[model samples]
Target: MTRVVFVLLPEVHLLDLAGPAQVFAGADGFGQPYTLDYVAERPQVLSAEGLPLVARTDWPVLGRDDLIMVPGWRGPVLRDGPVLHASAVERLRAHHAAGGTIASVCAGADALGQAGMLDGRRCTTHHQLQDELAARYPRATVVRDVLFTTDDRVVTSAGIASGIDLALHLLAARHGPALAARVARDMVVYARRNGNAPQASAMLRHRSHLDDTVHRVQSLIDTHYAEPLPLSRLAAHAGVSARTLTRLFAKATDGLTPLRYQQALRLERAEHLISQGTTVESAAREVGFEDARMLRRLRR
Candidate 1:
């Protein structure tokens, strides 16, 4: 069995740790189960939600692994604390040197950055920490808009819920898309198997100073998803060139392509309709997908 370890830190987000742990622990690929364990710098750690986690082992157990996950650490106070033991850093370095796959959720990237593992790697974290991460790790390409980023050996996820997305991705990477899709379906999270799909978290935080062109384009797509929308017409209505509209769409919508953002909005609306007892076909039509088959195909 492949061994998977989660290094629990003080003030770790409970969901961030639990999401990946459940995915890997439940993943029965290669006709064998994974051996999952939780370790910490000490025997016990408190979660951000006031729950306590009791670890099975301490830092001495850091060894070869199929994967190692680090959940986000405590908030800013713990981050600024000078009491972080150097032994934890050395152990992570040693684990990475031995070719272990390293993954972090949310602010857990801060620990990896502190250990100098994320230097020159493309990574992400919660949007609130984007500027701080960029300032702290000059060599790293810090992206804020995406759910997660994988650069060879290191993988980092943005925010709390994105940890689940990252775990699904890891399952897909290690096992196969089929198994990953199975896990996601089992969790009732249907949209994460396809990489680059727009996540709800992408649009949760509203930006001020609405760009009228982008707003008009999005409003049209939202209200008229069932109708065929010509891109040229949309651009004209927004008073911008088609090419310029594309650029602004990407910038205004957190790197989502215009068409993709529209599709996501439609899907979100479809989900809402479904929750209200609408049939899948009705929901599909309501969301601007003319055919139910197309909606199923795109989501799958």
Candidate 2:
């Protein structure tokens, strides 16, 4: 059986913690393989929404796990709380070093950032804190617009509801897109879109400055994720050299290389359809993966 440990702190966002718990706990097949536990610095913690959660074990006494999920912190109070212990941080680092997966939701990225797990990696948090997160973790590629990001074994999501998306992504990774889609259907959520789906959020529009070139690129990618997108063609459409396009893209976007950026968009869309209960093969093909084997590899 797989074991998942959720690290809870005072003033934690209840949904940020509960969303993922429900997804993982409801995973189908193998008799619900995961053993989920809520472990905290103590046996009890208060949620930002005023709910009380009892930890299954105190931090020091908790056992190791296949995955460690850190839910978003309450607010400035928890973020600045001197009482927020570092034992969780130490355990997270140790877990990652041992090849275990570590994931965070919403401002939970802040906790992971504090632990240095996000250094030199791509991550996302609630859009409202993107600037601060980027400023505080200069080495991290802090994405403000995406729903979530996963790199180097560290998975991070945007605010509140995005935790559901993150959890579905985890299911897809551990089991398969088929299983994830089932979970999403049972939960009545659009299937977990892959991490790379096109983001149609207002935040991205603001950051893109409504620039014609940027919009064109995004639009083209959205329409052509399944088709081949050569850099030369994309640059030609943008009226710029490939090199110039790359440079401008880095400045205009969230620091993803053009190819990587496109792939991310495709995956994001795929995950969404899957979460909405789309079949794995259909979802992969819908997102432009011609080969099911290829989609499986990339999903992992």
Whose lDDT is greatest here? 2
Candidate 1 on 1-300: residue-level lDDT in tens?
Answer: 677778787788898998887777667643547878787768888898999999965543444557777888657532472233587677678788898778899888888888888898998888778788888889999976777888867888987878888988887777777787777777777556332433333244323327888878877766676677778978998899999999988887677666786676677667656654689899998777867997787667
Taking all chains together, the TM-score of candidate 2 against the true structure is 0.65
The lDDT values for all models are: 0.75, 0.78
Q: Which ten residues in a row have the lowest lDDT in candidate 2?
A: 198-207
Per-residue lDDT value at 207 in model 2: 48
- Candidate 1 weakest lDDT stretch, 10 residues: 193-202
TM-score, candidate 1, is 0.68
TM-score of every candidate: 0.68, 0.65
Residue-level lDDT of model 2, residues 85-200, one tens digit each, is 67778888988987888998888888888899989999988877788888878899987678889897899988888888888988888778878878888889944655654335
The numbered model that scores best in TM-score is 1
